[model samples]
Target chain A: MTSAEATAHYFKKAARIMDVGERIETLLAAPLREVKVQVSIELDNGEIRTFDGYRVQHDNSRGPMKGGLRYHPEVDSDEVLSLASLMTWKTAVVNLPFGGAKGGIRVDPIGLSSKELERLTRKFVDQIQDIIGPTRDIPAPDVNTNPQVMAWIMDQYSKYHGHSPAVVTGKPIDLYGSRGREAATGRGLLYIAREIARDVGLPVKGTRFAVQGFGNVGSHAARLVHEDGGIIVAVSDVNGGVKNPKGLDVPALFDHARKTGSVKGFGGGVPCGSEELLTCDCDVLIPAALGSVLTRSVAAEVRAKIILEGANAPCTPEADEVFEKKGVLVVPDILANAGGVTVSYFEWVQNLQHVTWDEDRVNTELEKLMREAYERVANISRTRKLPLRTSAYVLAIGRVGKATVLRGI
Target chain B: MLDQLMKLPMCKGLSQGEATELASIARESQAKKGTVLFAQGAHGDSILVVLEGQIEVSMSGQTLAQVGEGSVLGEMSLLGEGGKRTATATVLSDARLLEIDAARFQELLKTSHLAALKVVANLAQVMSKRLLAMNEKLIEGNKGKKEELADFQKILSNWSF
Candidate 1:
C-alpha cells in the first residue's frame, strides 16, 4: 500500500470503531492545506536547480500545527500529506496542545554539498516563511534532515519573521535546541516498553530485543533497553545488521558504527542483512527504521512475541492482521515514536518562554507524558478487546474529532 | 373556433364533445410578440389558452419560462379566490389565444357535471405539482441553516465551555 493509504487504513479502522460517521471522518481526515512550491536554488557550482517542496498543514483545531521537515529523494506530496495527518493523530494521542503539519523537499540531502544544501534550505524557507511561525506551523527534523538543517531553516526563517527560535525545533543546543530532544523518540520507547513488560510479565531486565534500523531512533532505543538489562540480540542499519542470540554489546556496537559508519563491521556478533534482522531471534522486535517493512510475509516469519513500532507506519494493515491472529502485541508508532515530537514541543515551549530546561527535567516531563498516554490507550485496549494500535488511534481520533466539532468545523 | 384551444391544461380528461363545447365559449384573440397577455398581481377572471407561438412567463421582469403551443395562461386566476395573476405572461411571438371568461365556465359546469369534475381534477393535479416544486426549493434554501444549527446543538450538549 502507499504510505497515505496505510495511514488512512488505520485511521478508518479506528474511526469505524468510534462510529463517528463518514462526514466527520472525511472532515477530520482531510488536511487543512496542502502547499507545494518550487524551491529553485543556485548550487555551489553556479548551476540553478529547482526542487519540489511540500508542506501539508493537516489540522490546527487544538492549536498550531507541528511536524518535521524531511529531506529525501522519495519525498512527495502523498507521503508528506500522510505524514501530516499522522502527526495530527500523534499529537492528539500524546495529548499535546498542538495539531499536525509536515513538510519535505523531494531532493536527497546526501547528494548536495554543504553550500548547496544550505542554499536549498534557505530557498525553501523563503518559499514558505510567510505561512510558518512560532504560533503557526512549526517544523522539526526528520529522515535525512538534522540539527544543522533545522538551524539553517531557523536562520533563514528569521530573516523574514525576525528572531523566532520557537519557529523550528531540533536545532543545535547552542542554537536553542532542547537537550533531551536528540534521544526523545528512543527514550519514549523505553518508557513504553517498561510499562508493557510490567503488564505482560516479560520483565525489561531479561527481555530479548531486536531493533531494525540503528539510526537516531533505533540505536538510542537499543542502548536504553540494554541499560535496563534487556538483551540486545540483533540490530541493523541501512548499511548492514548484526545479531547475537546471547546479546550484542550495545556500547561497542555504537563505537563501531561511529567509526565505520555502519553496523556491518561490528565484531560482537554475526553480520546479518537488514531484511533478515526483522525476523531475528528475540522476544521483542523494534522496527524503528523505514515504514512498510513489516508486511504480511514478514509478519508471518516474525517470531517476536511483542513488536514495538519506533518508526512511523512500520507495519502495513495486512501485517497487522497477521500479528492479530498470532497474538503479537504491537505498540504503535504514534505512541512509541512520539517522543521526538513530544520533546520538540518541550523545546518549542522553552523557546517561547525564553528559557532552557535541564536534561533531567526534560526526561522526567517526557516520561510522565508518555506514561499517561500509554495508560489511556492500554485501558481502552484491555476493556474494549481492541488492538493497541486501534485503541491509540481511537483515542487520538476521538480527541481531534471533538476538537474539530467543538471549534465549529 | 380553434380546435387546439380546446386543449386547456384544466381540460385534460374532458371528452371531445365536452372540450369543443368549452372551446365554443372561448373568444378568439391575437396579440403580437412582447405583448403582455397578463401581468403579475393583476386581477383576472379569464383563462387564456395559447393556440400557436410562444409566451414567456416572468416574475418582476425576470423571465421564468418560455412556453409554446397548448400552454395555458392565467389558469390559476380562474381557480383562485383573489383572481390575481401570480406571474406575468408576455407573448414571445404573434400568436393565437382563446380567452374563456370564468363566469361562462362556471355556467357551463352547472349543466355539465362530468366535464366540470374532470377539469377541476386536472387543475388540482397541476397545482399540487407546483406546490411540491416550491416545497423543494424551500428545503434547499434551509439546508445550510439546518447544518449550522446542528453543529450548535452538538456543541451545546457536549461542550463544557
Candidate 2:
C-alpha cells in the first residue's frame, strides 16, 4: 500500500479499538486546510520552470499545524495529506502543542541549480506565507529538503512579515535553529531503545543491533548505540550493507561513510545485501530507511525480537500482522521517529521566543518528553493488552478527539 | 561460568573452546569493601568484569557512576593506548572480579579467536561511546541567558518595511 493507504489502515484499526463513531472518525481524519499553488521560478539559464506545490493542514484542534516540506518528483496531495495527518497524530503522541501540516513541491530538487532552488523556495513561501506563522502552520525539512532549504523559507517569509523566524523550522543552527535538531531523531531512537532495554531485561550496552538505512537517523542511532556499548553488526545505506558478526567497527564505518558517502565498501566488514542485512539475526532491528520495506515476505524472514522504526511508515499492514503474530514488538514510526518533529517544535519555540537552546539542553528536554510519552503509551499497552502500534495510535487519536471536542469542533 | 560468559555481550554465543580460551586469560580476584581495584593514571591494562557486588568508578574526585554485576570496566584503557587507567575504581561492597589479561587477549586476538574478537569489538565500542560523550561535552554550551532573550513580538511588530 502507499503511505496514505497504510496510514489510513492504521488509523482505522485504532479508531475501531476506540469505538468512536464514523462521524468523529471522519471529522478527525479530514484536513483543516488544503493549499495548492503554482510556483513559477526562473532558472539560471533564463528558463521559466513551473512546479505544483501543495500544503495540507490536517488538523488544528490542539494548536497550529506542523509538518515538513519535501521536494521530490512524486509530491502529490495524497502523500502530503497522509504525512500531514501523521504530523497531527505525531504531535499529539509527543504531546507537542501543535497539530499537523505538510507541504511539498513536485520537483526533483537534484536537477535544480542553487539559484533556481532558491527562487522556487522563495516563490513557494510567497504563495503560502499568509497561512503559516508561529501559531498558524510551521514547515520543516523533509525528504530532499535540508536546513539550507529551511533557511530559505525563513528568509523568504521574513521578507513578507518582518523577521518572523518561527514561520518555519529546521533552519541552520547559526540561523536561529535549535542545536540538537540535527541528531534529534536518532537520539530519540536511542532513548526509546534504552527504555525498551530497561523493560525487556536486555542491557543496551552489549545487545546486538542491525540498522537499516545509514542516514541521519540510522547513523546517529548506530553511533549512540555503539557508544552505549551496543554491538552493531550490520549497517546498510542505499548502496548496500556491510556486516561483521563480531561487531562492525562503527567509528571506522562512520569515517568510511564520511569519506566515501556510503557504508557499503567500508573494508571493516564483509559486503552484505540489503535483504541479508534486514533478515540478519539481531536483538534490535532498526528500519530507518525506506517505507514499505518490511512486507509480508521480509517481515516473515525478520529474525529480530524488536523492530524500532526510524523511518516513516516502514511497515505495511501485512508485515505488521506477521510481527503481531510472531510477537515482535514493532515501535511505530510516529513514536519512534517523532524526535525530528519534536526538535522542530523546539526550534520554532526558540525562534518565537528569540532565545536559543544548547544541544545538551535540547537533548535533555527531548529525553524527558520521549520517556514520558513512552510511559504513557506503555501503560496503555500494558493495561489494555494492546500492541504498541495500536496503543500509540489510540493515544494520539484519543488526544486529538478530546481536543476537538473541547474546541467545540 | 561459561554460560554466564556466553550471556555477556562481550562473549555472546561463543564456541565452547573460544569461551574456554577467553576464560583462561582471566585472573579472578576477591576483595573486601574499600578495596581499590585500580587507581587513576596507574598502569592498569586488564579488563574488569564485575561478577559480584558493586564498585564505584570516579574521576577527579567526583564519582562518575556505580557499576554492579555484569558491568565491565577498565576495558577502555585496556583497548586504549598507553594502557593507563583513566578512572579510579573502588569496591563499594565485597566483590569478585575477573581481570582479563591484555597480553593474553592480544595473543588470542592475534590468533583470530572469535570470542576474543567479540570482546575487542565491544571494548572499542564502549570506549568510542565514552569518547562521543566527551565530545558532546566539549561542544555543549550553557543555557540561553535571560539578558539575551529578545522581545520577539515587540521587536517584530514595531518593524516596518
Candidate 3:
C-alpha cells in the first residue's frame, strides 16, 4: 500500500477502537487544503528546470499547522499528505499547541549547486508564501534539509512580514535557530527507550542495541545510549552495515564514518548487510532509516525485544501485527520521533519572544516533555490493555477528536 | 578606550600606533539609561562606537537590533550619501560611546591609506551582509506578491478567451 493508504489504515484502526462516528472519521481523514505549485529555476549551466512542489495542510482545529519541508526525489502529494496527517497525531501525542502540515519539492538536491538550491528555495517560498506564516503554517527541516535551509526560509519569509523569525524553525543559531535541535530526535528516542527499558526490568548498562540507520537520529541515539552503558552491537547506513558483538566503539565509529563517509570499513566491526543489521540479536532495535522496512516477512525474523521507531512510518501495519503476535513492544513513530518537532516548537517560542535559550534549557525541557508524554502513553497502555502504539494513538486521536467536536466541525 | 576601539571589526588590522591615532580623533561621551543618542531620519554627522553598555536600534518604537561593547553604530548613515539616520539609537544602560565626526574620519583615511583601506573593506563586508539578508527578505516579499498576481492572470486567462 502507499504511505497515505498505510496512514489511513492505522487511522481506521484507531478510530474503530475509539468508536468514532463515520462522519467524524471522514472529516478527520480528509485534508484541509492541498496546494501544488510549479517551482522553476535557472541552473548555473543556463538551463531552466521545473519541479512539482506540494504543501498539504492536513488539520488545524487545534492550532496553527506545523511541519517540515523536505527536498527529495520521492516527495509527492501522497507522501506529503500522509506526513501531514502524521504531524497532526504527533503534535497531539506530545500535547503541543499546534496542528499539522507538510510540504516538499520533488527534486534531488544532490545535483544542484548551492546557488541553484537557494534560488529554488526562494522560488518555492514565493509560491506558498501566502499560505504560510508564524501563526498560519510554520515549516521546519526534514529529509535532505537542514538549518541552512531553514535559515533561507526564515530570511525569505521575514522580508514579507517584517522580521518574523517564528515563520520557520530549525534555523541556524545565528539566525534565531534553537539550541539542541540538531540532536532532538535521537535524544528523544533515547529518553523514551530509557523509560521502556526501566519498565521492562532491563537496565541500560548492559542492554544490546542494533540501530538500522546511522543518520542524525541513529548516531545521536547510539552515542547517548553508549554513554549510558548500552552496547550498540550493530549499525547501518545507506552505504552498508557494520557489526561487533562486543559492542563497537561508538566514538571511533562516528569518526570513521565521518572521514570515510560510511560505517562499512570500521576496524572495530565486521562488515554486514543492512538486512542482517536489522534482524541481529539484540535487546533493542531502532529503525531510524526509511519507512516500510519492517514488513511482515522481516518482522517475523526479528530478534529484538523492543522496537523504537525513529523514522516516520518505519513499520507497516502487517509488521506491527507480527510484532504483536511475537509479544515484542513497538514504540510508535508519533511518540518516538516527536522530539524534533517538540524542539522546533521551543525554537518557534524563542523566536516569537525575541529571545534565545541556552542548550541546557532546551535539552532539559525536551526530556521533561518526552518523559511526560511517555508516562501518559504508558498509563493508557496499562489501563486499557492496549499496545503502546494504540495507546499513543488513543491519546492523540482523543485530543484531536475532542477539539474537532468542540469546534463544531 | 583604544583597546576597545581596536576590537571593533571596522577598526581591526590596524597597527597599535594607527589605532592610537584613530582613538585620538574620537571623543568619548557618557549617556545615561533611557538616553536617545539619535533619532530616526536625523541628520547624520558622526558614527558612534560603543565602549561599554548596550544600545538598542529601533524604528517606530520596535527594537530591531541590540548592540553591545565593541559594536559600531550609525555607520550606515556615515556610509550612505544622503547622510540620514535609518534607525534611532537609544541607550539601554549607562553607556560610554566614542563618536567620530566625518571630518575626523576623513583625516584618519588621509593619514594612513592602510587603515583607511581596512576600514572601508570592513564596512563593505558589513554592508554586504546586511544587504544579503535584506535581499533574501525582499525577494520573498516581492516574489510572493508577483506569484499571486500571476495566479490571478492565469485565472483571468481562462475566462477571457
Candidate 4:
C-alpha cells in the first residue's frame, strides 16, 4: 500500500482506539471542503494545458488547516483527504495551532522544466488563493515537491497581497527556512530514543541503532545517534543497506551515500535489501524512509525493542499489532518527527515578524519542543497503561476535540 | 407557481408529519447580491428551493438562467454519479432557501408517495431544461477548439515536411 493509504489505515486504527462520539466520527468522515480548480497554465511549449488541482481542507476545528502540497500524477482528492486528515492528528499531537489541509496537482512534475513548473505552481496558487493564508491554510513540501516549489507558492501568494512569506513554509534557508529543518525529523528520532533509553535506565552511550534509509532523515538520524555515542550497526537506502555488528562508520556511510546517492558498495559493511533493514538486530530500529516498510510480514522478523517512525506511516496497522505483541515500543510518526513542523511554525512566525532567528536559537527551540513532547507522550504511555502510539493519539485527539468544542464547531 | 411551491400547498391533502419533515429540512441562509451559493465542481448534496428573492444559475461562471422563489437548483448534480455541482448558483438578491440533502430527499420519496410525484416531476422538468441549454454550449465550444488544434497541427506538419 502507498504511504498515504497506510496513513489512512493507521488513522482508522487510532480512531477505533479513541472510540470518540458519533459527532466526531461524522466530522472526520470527509473533508469540510474540497476545492477543485481549473489551473490553466501556458506551458513552455506554447500550449495551454488546464490541470485539475485540488485543495482538500480536511478539518479546521483545532485551528487552521496545515499540510504539504504534493505534485505528482497520482495525486487525487482522496489521497489529499487522507494526508490532510493525518496532518490534523499530527499537528494536534505536536500541540500546534493548526488542523489539516492537503493540496496538489495531478501532474508528473519531473517532466516539466523549472520554468514550466514555476508557471504551473503559480497558477495553482492563484486558483485557490481565496481560501488559503498563513492563518487559514499553510502549504509545505511533499512527494515531488521541495523548497523551490514552496518559494514559488509564497511568491505567487505575495503578488496578490504583499511580501507574505508566512503564507508558506519549507523554503530554502536563505528565504527564512528554519535551521536544522532538513534533519529535524532524524534529530527528533534521536531525541525520542534517548529519552526512552533514559527512562528505562539504559545508558544512551553504546546503544545499538539500525536506521533504514540514508536520505535527509535517515542519514541525519544515524549521525545524531552516532554522535550520542550510540552504535549504529546497520543503515539502508533505496539501493541497498549496510551492516556491521561492531558498529559501522556512520559518518563515512553518510558521506558515501551523499557521494554515490546510494548505500550500496560501501566498504566495511555487508549489503542488504530494504526489507532486511527492518528485521536487523538493534536496540532501536528507525524507519526513516518510505511508509509501509514495516508490514506484518517484515515486522515479525524485527528484533528491536523500539521502533521510532522517522517517516510518516512507515509501519502498517498489521505491523504495529505485531510490534505490540512483541512488547516493542512503537513511537508513532506524529510524535517522533514533529520537529519539522515545529520549526516550520517558527519560520512562519519569523516571516510574519520580519525577523530571522539564528541557527542556534532555532535548534535550541526545536530541541526543547521535541524533548518536552516526548516526555508528555512517555508519561501518558505510563499513566494510561497503553502503547506510546495509543497514548499519543489519545492526547492529540483529546486536544483537538476540546478545541473543536471550544470553538463551537 | 414558484411562490406556491415555497408555501408547499399544505392544505392539498398533505399529512401533518410530512409537512413537519419538510419544514424541518427548510433552512435559511443569507447571500449578498452576485455572491455564488454553490460553485461548479463543488460536492452538491442539497437541492435548494428559493423561498425568497432570486438567484442566477451559471455554467463556468456564465449565466445560464435566473431562478426566483420556489425555483430549485442542483437536483442533477446530486443525483448524478459524480455528485458535483455542475453550475454556479449566485444569489441575484437576498435569498431564503428550503434545502434538502439529495439522499434524504430521495429516501423521503420512498416513504411519502405524494411528495415523490411532485419532487420527481419537478426534478425531471428542471433537468430537461438544463440539458437543452448544455447541448448548445457544448456544440459552440467544440467547434472552436477543433479548429484551433487543427490549425496548430497543420503548421507542425508543414514544418516537418
Candidate 5:
C-alpha cells in the first residue's frame, strides 16, 4: 500500500478503538487542504518537463503544518495524502505543537540535474507559497530531498515573503538549518529502539539488529545501534545487503557503504537480498529503505520480535495483519520515526529566532520526548490490549482529538 | 549599573550599563516556580536573562539543565540574526529577570560593536565547546555501549542475557 492507503488504514484501525462519532469521522476522512499545482521546468535538453506537484496540508488544528516534500518516481496524490496524514499523526505523536502535511512531485529527483532540480523546486514553491508560512505550513527534507533542496525551497519562498527564514525547516545551517538534524531521524530510531528494548527486557548489549537500507536513516540507525553495543548482524542498501552471524561492524559497514553507495561489496559479510535481510534472525529488524518491504509474504517469514519502521509505509495492511498474527511487535512509522520532525521543529524554532543549540541539547531533548512518547504508546497498547501500531494511532488521534475539542473547532 | 551589567557573557555583550539601558528598553518581570518563562520554538521580540535565583531548561516537559544567578537563558534567540527559543526555560525558583526586546538587543549590538563582538565571541566559544563535547559524548556513549555489548556477547557466546 502507498503511504496514503497505509495512513487511511491506520486511521481506520485506530478509530475502531476511539469514539469515532460522526464529527470525528468527518475530521479524519479527508485532509483539511489539498493543493495541486503545475510545476513547469525547462530541462537542460531545452525541452520543458511539466510535473504535477502536491502539498496536502492534512491538518493544522494543533499549530502549523509540518512535513516533507518527497521526490520519487512513485509519487502520487494517494501516496502524498497518506504521507500527509502520517505527518499529522507523527507530529502529534511526538507532541509537537503542529499538525501534519506532505508534498511531492511525480518526477524522479535523481534524474534531474542541479539546475533542473533548483528550477523545479523554485517553481513548486512559487505555486504553493501562498499556502505555506512559518506559522501556516512548514516543509522539510524527505526522500531524495535534503538541506540543499530545503534551501532552494526557502529561497523561492522568500522571494515572495521577504526573506522569511522561518518559512522552511531543514535548510542548510548557513540558511537556518539546525545542528544535529542530519542525524535526528537515525538518532530517533535508536532512541525508540532502546526504549522498546528496555520494556521488552532485551539488554542493549548483544541485542542483534538487522537494518534494510543504508541511506541516511538506515546507516545512522546501524551506526548508533552498533555504538550502543547492539550487534548489527545485517544491513542493506539499494544494491544489496551483508550479513554476519557474529555481527557486522557497523562503522566499517558505514564507511564501506559511504565509499561504495552499497553494502554488497563491503568485504565483511556475504551478500543477501534486501528481502532476505528483513527475515534474518535478529532481536530487532528495522526497515529503513523503501516502503512495502514488509509486505504480507515477508511479514509471515519474519522472525524478529520487534519491527521498528524507519521508512514510511514499509509495512502494508496485509503485512500488518500477518505480523499481528505472528505476534510481532511493530512500532508504527509515525511514532517510531518522529525523531526527524521533532528535530526539524527544533531547527525551525532556531531559524525563526536566529539561535543555534549544541547537538547534545538536540539529541538529549529528542531522546526524552521520543522515550516518553514510546512509553505512552506502549501503555495504551497494554491498556487497550491493542497492537502497538494501532495503539500509536489511537494515542495520536486521541491527542489531536482533545486539541480539536479544546480549541472548540 | 547598566555599564557594569553589560560585561557579563550571558548579557549578549551590552556594557553592564548598556544592558541596564537595554533592560529598561523592555518590560521587567518577576516569576515564581511553575511560571512559564518562555516556551520552546517561540519567536517574539523579547529575550530573558536570569537576574536572580534559577531557570530550568526544558523541552517537551523534561528538564535538561538549569540556568541560575546571572546566567543567560534566552539571549541565544535574541542576538542571532535569525533565532528562536529552542527550549522552554521555566522559572525554577522565585526569581527576577530582565526581558529585552529583539529590537533593543540588536540596537545595543549595533551601538557598541566592541561589546557586541566580545559577547558574540564568548557565546561562539561556549557553543563551540558545548557542541564539540556533545559530539564526543555521542560517539563515546555509543562506544561504551558497544564495548559492553562485545563483552556481553563474549560471555553469552555460551549463554544468554
Candidate 6:
C-alpha cells in the first residue's frame, strides 16, 4: 500500500477497535486543507526553475496545526497528507494542544546556493503566510529544513506581521528558539526506551542495540543509550554500516562520522551491510532512517527483541503483523519519535509567551511529558491486551474522537 | 569599572594592572532607551561593551541580536578591514556601556606587548567562539541536505526529469 493508504489502514484498525462510527472516522481521516503551490525561483546560473510545493493541514479540532516543512523531490500531496495525518495522531498521543499539518517543497536544497535557498524559502512563506501563523499553523524544522530555514521563514513572516517569532519554531537560539530542541527527538526516544526496558525487565546496562540510519535521531539515541550503559553494537548511515558486539565507541564514532560524513570508515567496528544490520542480533533495534524498511521478510529475519521506531512509519502493516507474531515488542513511531514535535510545542509556547527556557528546563519538561504519555499508553496496552501501537492509536483516537464529538463536528 | 571589564569574556585573562590601564583609556558612556549607539555602515573607531541593560543589533530595521551585560559590540567593525559597522546598535533600555577607542587600545597594545598579546589572544578566542557558533548553526541548518539530495537523485534516476 502507499504511505497514505498505510496510514489509513492503521487509523481504520484503531477506529474498529474503538468502535468509532463511520462519520467520525471519515471526518478524522480527511484533511482539513490541502494546498499545492507553484514555487518558481531563479537559479544562480540565471535559469528559472519551478517546483511543486504542498501543505496538508489534517485536523484542527485539538488546536492550531503544527508540523514540519520538508524539502525533498518526492514530497507529493499524498506523502504530505500521510505525514500531516500522522502529526495529528502524534500530537494527540502525547496529549499536546495541537493538531497536525505538514508541508514540503519538491527541490533538492543541496543544489541551491545559499542566496537561492533564502529566496525560495521567502517565496514559499509568502505563498502560505495567510494560512499559517502562531495561532493558525506553526511550522518547525523537518527532514531537510533546520533553524536557519526557520529563521528565514520567521524573518520573511515578520516583515509582514511585525516581529512575530511565534509564526515558526526551531529558529536559532538567538532568534528566540528554545534550548534542547535539536536533541529533543533522540532524548525523547531514550526516555521511551528506558520505560520500555523497565517494563520488559531488560537491564539497560547490558542491553545491546543496533541502529539503522545514523542521522540525528539514530546518533543521539545511540549516544544517550550508551551514556546510560547500553551497548550500541551496530550503527549504519546512508554511506554504510559498522558493527562491534562489544559496543562501538560512540564518541569516537561520532567524530569519525563528522569527519568522513559517514559511519562507514570508523575504526571501532567491522563493516556490515545496511540491510543485514537491521536483522542483526541485538536486544533493541531502532530504524532511525527512512520508512518501510521492515517488510514481512525482513521482520521475519529480525532477531531484535524490541524495535524502537526512531523514524516515521518505518514498518509497514505486513511487517507489523510479522513482528507481532514473533513477540518482538514494537514501539510505534507516534510515541517513539514524538519527542521532536513535543519539544517543538515547547518552543512554540516559549515564543508565544516571549520567554526563553534554559536547556535543563526544556529537557526536564520533555522527560515528564514523554514519561506520562508512555505510562498512559502502557496502562491501556496491558488493560486492553493490545499491542503498544494499537493502544497508542486507541488512546489518540479516543482523545481526538472525543474532541471531534465535543466540538460539535 | 576595571572589575566589571575583567568580568567580561573579552577581558577574561587580563591582569589587574593591565585591566586598570585599559580602563583608564576607556570612557564610561550611557544611552537612554531608543538611543542608537552607532548606525549601520557608519565608520566605527570604538568597541562598546555592555555593562548594564541591553543593546539590540539590527539592520534595515530588523532586529538581529540582543547583546546584554558582558557582551561586546562593534568588535566586527574594529576587526574588519573597512572599519565600518555592519549593523546598527540601539539601546533597548537605559544602558551603561564602556567604550574603548580602537586607536587608543592599539596604542596600549603597542606599549605593553604582554597585555597586547593577552588582549589579542582573548579577541581571537571570542572571534573563534562566534565563528564556531555560526558554523554549528550552518551545520544544523544543512543537516539533511546530502541525504535529501540523494533522495532527489534516486527520484530523478527513476523518472525522466
Error of 5 at B133 (Å): 77
- lDDT string for model 6 (A73-143, tens) is 77888899989999999999999999999999999888888999898999999899999999889999898
Q: All models, DockQ values?
A: 0.08, 0.00, 0.00, 0.01, 0.01, 0.00
Candidate 4 structure quality by residue, lDDT tens digits, A1-409: 6777766666555556655544455666567889998888888889988888989888888777888898889878888888888788888877878888888999998888999999999988888888999889999888888999999898889999788888888998888676667877777777778788888876669888898888778888889889999999898888888899899987788788778888888897888777887888788889988878888999899999888899988888888889999998888998988877777788888887988888788878877888888887777778658788877776666666666655654
Model 1: colliding residue pairs: none
Residues A1-409, candidate 3, lDDT per residue (tens digit)? 7556787788888767766556557888899999999999999999999999999999998899999999999898988998999999999999889999999999999999999999999999989999999999999998898889888888887778788889999889888888998889999999998899889999888999999889889989999899989999999999998999899999999999999998888899899788888899899999999888999999999999999999888888999999999999999999999999999999999988988899899989999999999998998889768899988887877777767755764
- C-alpha lDDT score of every prediction, in listed order: 0.88, 0.86, 0.87, 0.78, 0.82, 0.87
> Which residues of candidate 4, in runs, are more than 4 Å off?
A1-18, B1-161
Q: Residue A239's C-alpha lDDT in candidate 5?
A: 83
TM-score of each: 0.79, 0.71, 0.71, 0.70, 0.70, 0.71
DockQ score for candidate 2: 0.00
Identify the leading candidate in terms of DockQ: 1
Q: Is candidate 5 or candidate 6 better by TM-score?
A: 6
Q: Give the alpha carbon lDDT tens digit for every residue of A1-409 in model 2.
A: 8867998899999877766656567877999889999999889888888999999999999898899999999999999999999998899989999999999999999899888889899999989999998889999999999989999998888888888889888898888888989889999999999998998899899899999999989999999999999999999999999999899999999899999999988898799887788899888999999999999999999999999999999899999999999999998988999898999989888877889888888999999989988887888788879999888888888778767755654
lDDT of 5 by residue, A339-385 (tens): 99999999888877778898999999999999989988888788768
Cα miss at A351, model 6 (Å)?
0.8
Any runs in candidate 6 off by more than 4 Å, and if so which?
Answer: B1-161
Instruction: RMSD for all candidates, in order, please.
Output: 8.2, 31.7, 28.3, 19.8, 25.4, 28.4
Residue-wise C-alpha lDDT for candidate 6, range B13-127, written one tens digit per residue: 8899988877887899889999999999898888898989998999998999988988888765344343778899999999999998888777766676566558778888988
Every model's TM-score on chain B = 0.80, 0.78, 0.80, 0.60, 0.74, 0.83
Q: After superposition, how far is residue B116 of candidate 4 from its true place, in Å?
A: 36
The CAPRI classification for model 6 reads as incorrect
What candidate 5 gets wrong by more than 4 Å, as runs, is: A1-3, B1-161
- Native interface contacts retained, candidate 3: 0.00
Q: What's the residue-level lDDT of A331 in candidate 1?
A: 97
Count steric clashes of candidate 3.
Answer: 1
